[model samples]
Target: MATKPEFLLIGPGGVGCIAAFTINYNHTANVSIVVRRDYETVRKHGYHIDSVDYGKVDGWKPENVFASVEEASKSGIKFDYIAVSTKNLQDIVPVEELIAPVVSAHSVVVLVQNGFGIEKPLFAKFPQNIVLSGVSHIGSHNRNGHIHQMQSDHLVISAFENPNVDADSQVAAANRFIEMYSNNINKCVYFASAKWYRYRKLVYNACLNTTCALTGVDTGRLEAAGGLEAIAIPAMKEVIRVAKADGVELPDDVINVVCHADDGDYFEPSMRVDVKKGNPIELEAILGNLLDTARKLKVETPILDLLFKLLTVVQFRLKEANGYVGVPEKRPIPDTFFK
Candidate 1:
């Protein structure tokens, strides 16, 4: 009999735990996870999940769990799909370096994170491997070993073209992943290109995520302060303009859909949560990269530019507190390091 395909997920945060749960729930492949802080708690007690879509499932564990990717690499298993659902904080460490130990030539790297230009570095690092870009719209948070998934989950995935790898092989790997991962309970759709979805998501994120972090408020508070109309909507319009300049034209109605996305049921975005915990936010991947593209395309984005500048100060404070001072040195790994 043919062996079942192997799947591994790094970063068992809110998003990572839920994805691992659902993928293991499907039981189409062998699922494994690499967890850091909560490894002991999870390995002993397992995950306590309360999801609206999947309902309550306590003491849930994947087939195998490890403390780190380096540990998982020594398990004598070649991973078919390695999904990363961590925050895209490239300043701290590149995603490419984090999962380098287990990325085989046959393995497909799936990025289930936010921000623009996130897939570029991974592609450059693993041109021989197929890299898939994923944009996840899920509302979940993990406190200790307990996870709460308040909103329904939706993931849009697409393969990033690699000149070194052929097109047919890339699509085949992507389809295999979707086949094993997607089910009747959770939604994961395959799109032709994930660029449009990335831009559309920023219509909500670049405005509310940044503003909430700076002002230390939630969505309802921002709307109550007239920021929904004054700050969020206008900034979303600028994002649409920038997307248009970059060849992805977003509809005008997206402003209304995104601005009032959380009308009465409002919660804090990830950036605000990071700010509350004094963690470094994804400053470069989300706003800085978008603004760089705007400047190159000659698109006017005064609102986003101001938000970027102010958020940079917030980021500097977090970095200073963590003592990440001065320029970072280049971290070089062997080109043939993958198994």
Candidate 2:
């Protein structure tokens, strides 16, 4: 009999739970979830998934749950793949330690998170050969202890191709990972060249996330307010220009998709949630990255610059108010043609 691929998921947050559930539900992979604590809770309660599409699935326990990577290592457990889904701001030290023992030179490490260039920091810690960067449009949040999946879109996997890593091999691996959830489901997994996938996602995020965050409205409402023509269209053009300056080739249709994507009303950008909850937003990851890239490539980004400035002020005001409970003055975007 073929041995099941050992999969280890670090963190049991919304994304982590969905990944764990997806992997366990569809594939024969021997999956385990590593948590900082709450092993008892997970063991007793199992994994609970409340999805708008899949409905509620309860009492589904992982093959194993470990409190820490240290514990898993001491128990002599080895993982073929490690999926890191921690919050973007969490210290990477713990994650490094967790992957240290289990990650081999050949083992694949898939990072399912938002933002651009998140793989750079990890590359400094681990060999680039084993690192794979992924971006997904999967919306999920935790309610009580259950994970609620709001939407499932395509999962894009990318990494710098190496001789040991055949192009087809990565695609096959990505498909295996997707099959963990795509059975009879319309959701598909795509493996593509890192440059195109990363930049495409970057453009989509740069437009959609920033607009949703700045407007403090849901995606549907934002799209309804001529956001595509006003914000997303302009912002996406800037993204394409910046990507071109950076030598990243983007498709002509990328802008159209960003402007007209069916992201659903239930979709909530992380930055908007952070602003609403008064948590520190990923200004650096979403907007800051675009601005920085533009500067690096000598590309002008007036729209992004104005957007970033507005968001910075909004964030500061929120911090001053201690939360979004009180209303703040609505700042108008300075007049400028970014083209």
Candidate 3:
């Protein structure tokens, strides 16, 4: 390991930027962010963040910024961790192809993304490297290319349970990673079962994210328009049921907490923002993956099934509105990844 932990954070959107800011603000680790669109602007002015919780920070630059992972990888610098906030790129490019140049034999790979089965391809390639799954409860979004910090509790974290990998090493690496990040933001809770962590976050994403996207509103508006009871609550119920079928039990009152987030903590989720911007939403990762798993488990998610069909229609329409014709490529999941 290097004397100081360095990270290559891919996809500097809401989720990615918050993590980048938290670490960079606390000066916890040296962060190298991949600035895909606004390289020059970010390199010069950095970002101006407005927040209700994290306070305001104007013009903060990370340690290093690269246009792409390939560019960063060629710097002859191996990062201790690679944090990805986008959908898994197994279909577009192999994980090894993307991060091989930036990692050593013992690099810890952590993905703070929303979805299921995010670890399969990574484990398939790097059977010995530590792999972790993170669940972010942050109610934040990006506005005019800056992260808007809203509210959050604990960031649920866990390393995946892989039979082929050394379990003890994974736990130790996870604890070390969490320790490096404990100085900033909020609490970092280490959950032993990454499987359970992923599904529980899906309870909110599969319900609120999709509901807000389809209705063209934020969580608070959805609750105001009565979509909370008419839509969100039922969808969460389906999520709980499917989670159980997959052998993860959830609490009975999760619905109340999931729907009514704090009183003024209403912000458009990334899904709603993506739909409005005519960009392809993370439908597959947040919704498609869940529906697929529900099917494998033979769990009947009537509400979720309906919302899935409806959201796909809205997603297609939004893409068309943006003049994007080609459908996004989907990844084929292996049966071995399932529990």
lDDT accuracy of residue 23 in candidate 3: 79
Ranking by TM-score: 1, 3, 2
Give the alpha carbon lDDT tens digit for every residue of 115-170 in model 2: 66555555556644456666666777765567888886456666534444566776
In candidate 1, the residue pairs with backbone N, CA or C atoms under 3 Å apart (3 or more residues apart, or in different chains) clash, namely none
Give the candidate number with the greatest TM-score: 1
Q: Which ten residues in a row have the lowest lDDT in candidate 1?
A: 325-334
- TM values, all candidates: 0.89, 0.76, 0.81
Looking at model 3, how many pairs of residues clash?
0
lDDT of 3: 0.77
Model 2 stretches with alpha carbons more than 4 Å out = 36-40, 51-55, 90-102, 150-154, 160-186, 220-232, 262-267, 309-339
Task: For candidate 1, report its TM-score.
Answer: 0.89
Per-residue lDDT of 59-134 in model 1, one digit per residue for the tens? 9999999999999999978999899988888878789999999999888899899888787788888879898887
Give one clash count per candidate, in the order shown: 0, 0, 0
> What is each predicted model's overall lDDT from 0 to 1?
0.87, 0.71, 0.77
